[model samples]
Target: MKGPPMPAPLSRREFIATSAAAATLATIPVVHAGGSDLLRVGLIGCGRRGTGAATQALHADRNVRLVAMGDAFEDRLEESLATLLRDKEVADKVDVKKENRFVGFDACEKVLASGVDVVLLTTPPHFRPLHLEAAVKAGKHIFAEKPVAVDAPGVRSVLESCELARKKNLSVVSGLCLRYDWGFRETVKRLHDGAIGKIVALRANDYRGSNWGKARQKGWTDMEYQMRNWYNFTWLSGDFNVEQHVHFLDVCAWVMKDRYPTSAMGLGGRQARTGPEFGHIYDHFSVVYEYDDGTQLISNCRQQPGCKNNISGHVYGAKGH
Candidate 1:
């Protein structure tokens, strides 16, 4: 039996326009060329990464303003806005009003309807699919962070949203920065240009200490606590592999000419941080990915502290490594 039919290949315009880039909210040139004067941005998450993205967006262009902000918690939303206000360079561009400050689970929907041209989906991986669909439906450009989804179903949803965005001529850039880094881009280009010859095997590693986590406060419910400490739960963050190590995996795929692995077998478990506060995610993962061309990608990532950090990847080819 034959497999399912493939979609038509993306044209050069679609490829260039929809390709994920580093600058999330700095696409004012496109917006301006498309006959827009100002770029209004809405931030859906208020954590460190979200705040940083917002700051970058504000600094990217003078015609850009943060018109809306949303988060699951009011305090986080307030803190993010205050942080933006304190930034002297981008302070004047921060114009989020009181009514535009949305809090609670439905904050994303409200932000999308707040007369914004761009929306940053910086929430946890679990909420990404829902928020992205809403953004695309509202005809807003998107800057979704890495690990777009926590599970396969969410990934499918995100793909559908991206397709819709493409059809609408809207840009959807990802949080994957490796694609934008000049150094990495040049290196990958050389590798693809036969600098490494016929590549055979690859190795990637991301060994580091635990990321931030918070103890449950007094009045917070289980749901609230999980949302606050999202990184610890696989349902929220997709574990360290999807949440953090996706960069390395992406690098591996880029080296392989964008050919993803076919399958893999792996085992992971919590070693150092086994407390209940850490949730149910494993602290380490080791997997070997097998591609259709017989290439293998050995990947590993860990979150235990003081375990000799090593964050690098290498591709071995026939002519040279």
Candidate 2:
């Protein structure tokens, strides 16, 4: 279906002004552009990744400011703000008086309502759909991290939100930053130019050390702990396969210029880290995806320390390697 109509493009000056305003409010503490200048930014999650993302966004352009911060945990929000404030570059751009930091489940909405022009959705994959929907409804541009969703339902929601974003003329940049890298872009161009002939098969592997975190304390609700230790939960992380390995999956698809695989089968299970606190996620996974032309794509990923960190993807064509 056709998506919503795109919003009018912002003038260069307007864009700069909005970005600068956002930077001031978010606590980057940089010099303000001028009167009527502001690009307010809101952060939805306050985890390490989320805080890191906020740093990048603030540094992406001088015109942007982080004006609002929100998270379920007050400690996370405070820690993120402190870290941002500690950085001179970020501190100089942030407006201490105007910035509105919030906590609790509904804090996201408060941030949005506080006149943020850009929203950074760094929450867990499971909550991505809800956040995206809210941002789209508010007509705000978004910078959402990878693995947009953890399930079919969430995927459908994001797809719909993408449409709304298009209609609103909003820029929705995914966290698939590799796609923006110079080398990857050049490789994709070459593949599209038939530098790799008609691709027949592919293999990709992401082998690395474990990325496990301590479990939550007793008496915490499932939702609370799940949010804190999100990487360990299937519903929140979509497993290591879709969560971390999806990069390789995306790379293969980009090289082949295809999105859908006819069918997929895989086997995965948690071996080293065995405990109820670990949630339902496999520490190792190997999957085979078949395309319409009978082309096969094999992908394997493992999360165990001491293993080599090798990320390689190969494509086989009719002309042979």
Candidate 3:
């Protein structure tokens, strides 16, 4: 029997075009800063994810200040700066001097050069590898959101970068927030202590909400807007399964103490949100992952409205002890 055909590779031009477009749509306006003597923090992307992350980082420590920001679009950088300075919680924590705001492709470089100790990489998955590589090279601790890469090539790059991060003793944490949750940790600990004697299989599910949707706006090129709203693109978001449900997949992997799955067979499609702007991502998916020891991990995810937010998983053991 023959195997499934591989996806066609994206040309360099296609990649650049999509990235450029997304950068423009997602740009935020910048705000002016107040002072110095603050622990400088740089944000590489200014989307909702990036803004939320900046707020959290500020709240995490008093010394930390959002000293610099970078985005492909000037508008996004400015908008993000304005929001941060306006939010009562974030405003007090940010120092948005003219010298601290940066815009354009090279803005990331400038932010790093400005003496940032920690960097937040919340760019689209397609651009994550590049941003992560730069942060690692600059010897800065990093907080990168989930779905680190969009494709096999990008994943390989991230793994290699992860290696360098370990060597540098940099605290490189993925945005898999569940790993930090107390309730989840308690359950995992019991299982490890023989609460489940010799695990055999596991199953996980994430069925909630509708896929991404965007309204048209002026000065936004198709490529730029496409990149700005990347959750719908496979090459940028790595498919809904990998992008959103990977948290459950990662949980199963963590419990089993494994990295790669032995083999996988799955099905996916676009049951809803079928539009030109919506690229080649499946709105629903089911995958079965088999481990070397014959243990199996089944994962399913769907993005349809009116569905309850139910994310749960269970591990089965031989003895059921």
Q: Number of clashes in every candidate structure? A: 0, 36, 19
Task: Indicate the TM-score of model 2.
Answer: 0.87
lDDT of each: 0.86, 0.77, 0.75
> What C-alpha RMSD separates each model from the true structure?
6.9, 6.5, 11.9
lDDT per residue (tens digit) for residues 1-321 in model 2: 243343454553444334212122123334457645566778899888788888887785577778888888889888888898998877765653435878898988888898888788888788888999898899887888888999899999999998877777776767766676557767777777888688889998998887876577988887888878888888889988889888988888888775668899989878876776667778899889999879899999998776678877887887765
Candidate 2: deviation at residue 201, Å? 1.1
Tens-digit lDDT track of model 1 for 188-282: 88898999789999999999998777888899899999999999988999998999999989999888877888899998998898887888889
How many clashes in candidate 2?
36
What TM-score does each of the candidates earn? 0.91, 0.87, 0.84
| Poorest stretch of ten by lDDT in candidate 3 | 20-29
Best by TM-score: 1
Worst 10 residues of 2 by lDDT: 19-28
Candidate 2 or 3, higher lDDT?
2
Indicate the residue-level lDDT of 154 in model 1.
Answer: 95
- What lDDT does candidate 1 reach at residue 53? 95
Q: What lDDT does model 3 reach?
A: 0.75
